[model samples]
Target: GMADETILLADDDPMIVDPLALQLRREGFTVHIAVDGEDALAQARRVTPDVVLLDIMMPKKQGWEVCRELRAESDVPIIMLTARGEEMDRILGLELGADDYLTKPFSARELIARIRAVLRRVAMDSARQASPAAETASDDDVVQLGRVTVDRARYQVAVDGEPVHLSQREYSLLMALLDAQGAAVKRGDL
Candidate 1:
């Protein structure tokens, strides 16, 4: 639950940060604040936060730079926040490995929802990785969808018991979709 999660909020504006921090705290998250990009990186390394809410404009270092550095060091989920809603900025954030992005003037509820979604996605990914592909898998490893059966252990797939050819990328995409279990996977995530 949110009670156990720590959130690092990095933004220069107290007007945005103070109230937001209070709201998050009210929702039961342990909140950490950073006024600049450098401080953001510092707090992130120190606290090892469960998630990061990074604002795009800040002193010392920009959000994209911070996002790039953080992604290089850890798989911790990052949600980029910005007043700008340009498509290019959103694309750049995703390209830099941000887990999600939110434009400013957003409701606190939406922000919280995004945070939870990212957390859920990260947890699912971790669970998937915890089951090593190198280890032998029992019958439970097989996932069925419609006429397709995926043998995760064997890295093979069959349709109606007939082997189907799939590129590595295709197989990975298929696995990700199956992992969602009907959840809507955002395009940026894919």
Candidate 2:
């Protein structure tokens, strides 16, 4: 839930930051405010906010610089707020890896919705990485050891196109063996 999530909001205008911070806090987010690019990077590294609401025009460091720097190091979702509603500005922001773009004077509802949507996309991506893949995979997902083929996504092994059933312990041991890259692993460690 958003209650457990934090947001790093970077903007120079107190008028924008104060009211938005209040609104976000009221919606149950832990909001961290940064007045400029330097502060934004510091707070972002320290707080590791789940999302960032970055103003396109900030002092100390421009929003474009902050966005580029942040994208280079982390995939934390970013929503850019820009007073310049030009198509070129929007394109440039998206090209820099912003998850979404918000024009200035945008509706509060739309801002909140964008935040929620970006968060949801991030969660879904994490889930995909955690979930095991299926046997039907591209060439990248399968590994062959002589006649035996391992389907990493499905956690399945087969030889000559026939499945090899393995117990839970067996599967775990197999994974451990695979991870060792042929190096001997101590039984005690397992």
Candidate 3:
């Protein structure tokens, strides 16, 4: 599974880049190196690596910019690496759609673990989206709420073609309540 992954490591420091690249390659990943933000963007557009390890501070563009730009074009997973361990930087990176964050002076083993986790999540999400089970519903799908119809597959609720927006948790709770066969359902049952 690791053999199918191409990871882009974008850092300006050669000392940091060299060792990490070697370790990632040793783990059977195809590694691509970029020294700065601009080069990172270029390499991403070229190779479209499965995952990107981005340094916060780099020339031409910063990590935040690269993250935003990449997110606008593709839903590729990003993990921001920063030397600063400030809370604000971590919050800001997550707000910019980075899937994970790592501080510098981190161990190669830890970095590898983080990479595996992010990649696994991405793979699981893609699998869920592609699975036909997500498109079809069982015969027990509908929940009667006095006069409402809920279709879980299309994530839609309608009362005679009028749409209602319900969060996933809300929908699940409502369905559980409706399925109680006229008996009261406890709050913890949700």
Candidate 4:
């Protein structure tokens, strides 16, 4: 099922923006467009979209700056779009708070899939944070925190009864935090 989400697409090129926005709208998303980095920031504040597709090169401001500014304001997911497919560029985007990165010439289908994946992660995170005080664990190694659950015996995690796939690192970090029992775990300990 397609969720009714809003997307803010920031790109200076009409070639990419026009077709992409139309495709997103066809997929049941409310699409908004911005032609430059400054305009993108303005629209983001005005509309507060569920996701942002940000192009790297733009007049007046750059994508990285816009991403930094936006991240300071909210946890809104941002996907950095670039024509350059360099490893450094991708790493920089992620370090700058982008949830994902896509090199240009990507198919619309691939982009849509990425959008959905990011949205699911965001939803699960919010659910996990809903009620931290409700956390509990049993002798059976079943741990429950807010809407999230971790069954150590089965190596499984779920949110609101739905399975949530986690990377090995994520699972390990979660375990570390759980062991802390509301105390702060030193970063180096993880």
Candidate 5:
């Protein structure tokens, strides 16, 4: 529905990469494979894919390092794949700015669902940012939420200047709720 998205699949194993690429293609994604971290990074910069499916272990560059480097350059959504199932590994990946993670041996259906969820959130965020009303509220615009204040111009949110990072959806939802002026926001509104 969104222009037949492209995906970069980074894994060293042909067995894994081949089948995954085929499955993704059957589901309408144009897939590219990278056998190492350096190749993955290079391919990502070259193609500017809609999403990345990154495996944690590989020759030349590990997935975590690749994820860090990628985050430094772009905000493209990343979903990490790892054979390691430790809680710390998952936590570390998220801390490095991965959008999501899937362990090895995961079902294709679950992987697809995760990809769709991340893409939906990203699209929603993009739309909210591009809204005309949001564009008009340049610097010095203050949206008050009880004791909380969102300064649009400065891209800051605070309960008296203590900063917070609210997701685009959270910010939009908060604005919608405030605009209702204590009236009930129907489920359909969200």
Candidate 6:
């Protein structure tokens, strides 16, 4: 169903990369491999992939560096791959703007499920944005503050009829503040 999707798999191990590539291809995804984090960044810029499966420990540039750089330049979905015991690494990955995370030694089926779920969220958000009128609004869907308008259903914001680009966290924070409707939102409330 996702034949048009392209996934960038960045891992130093051929054993992991090769088998994962085959499985992903069989499931109708185009797979690209990067042996190092630096190569991963280069390939991501070149190919403009749909999603990235990044290994936390890689040569050249570490996955954290790659994820930070990618998040700065684009909002592409990133799923971090960490070793079994690296709970801190997984949390760090998310803080660095990863859309999801999967630990090492995971089954291909689980990985595929995560990818599909992420893609589906994106698709649904896109649909919501495209047809805002079709969805019911309970004052939380859209917010207007001065010239800026926030469309929470689609994760979009606009100012003076022009679209504005915001990262996921930025959008969430904006929505939260607007939800308060000019009331003081304590730091803990936010």
Predicted structure with the largest TM-score when compared to the true one: 3
lDDT of 4 at 2: 58
Candidate 3: Cα lDDT at 166: 87
| C-alpha lDDT of all candidate models, in order | 0.90, 0.86, 0.87, 0.90, 0.86, 0.87
Query: Could you tell me which residue pairs clash in candidate 6?
Result: none
Give the true-structure RMSD of model 4.
10.8
Order the candidate numbers by TM-score, best to worst.
3, 5, 6, 4, 1, 2
- Listed in order, each prediction's TM-score against the native is 0.71, 0.70, 0.74, 0.71, 0.73, 0.72
Model 1, range 114-187, lDDT digits (tens) per residue? 99999998876667658654222323678766798889989999999999999999998887777765578877
For residues 75-143, what per-residue lDDT tens digits would candidate 4 score against the true structure?
Answer: 999999999998998999999999999999998889999999999988876665575633443344788
Candidate 1 accuracy as lDDT: 0.90
**Model 5, span 1-190: residue lDDT tens:** 7548999999998888888888888889889899999999999999999999999998899999999999999999999999889798899999999999999888888888898899998887687667644533433377765678877767677986688898889888877765665468898998
Q: How accurate is candidate 5 locally (lDDT)?
A: 0.86
Off by over 4 Å in 5: 132-190
Residue 31 in model 3: shift from native, Å? 0.7
Which parts of model 4 are misplaced by more than 4 Å? Answer: 133-190
Error of 6 at 87 (Å): 2.6
TM-score of decoy 5: 0.73
Better of 4 and 5 by TM-score: 5
Alpha-carbon deviation at 59 in model 6, angstroms: 0.1
Candidate 2 lDDT tens digits, 1-190 = 7687899999999988888888888888899999999999999999999999999999999899999999999999999999889899899999999999999987767888899999998887676556434222223557666688888879899988899999989888877766664568898757
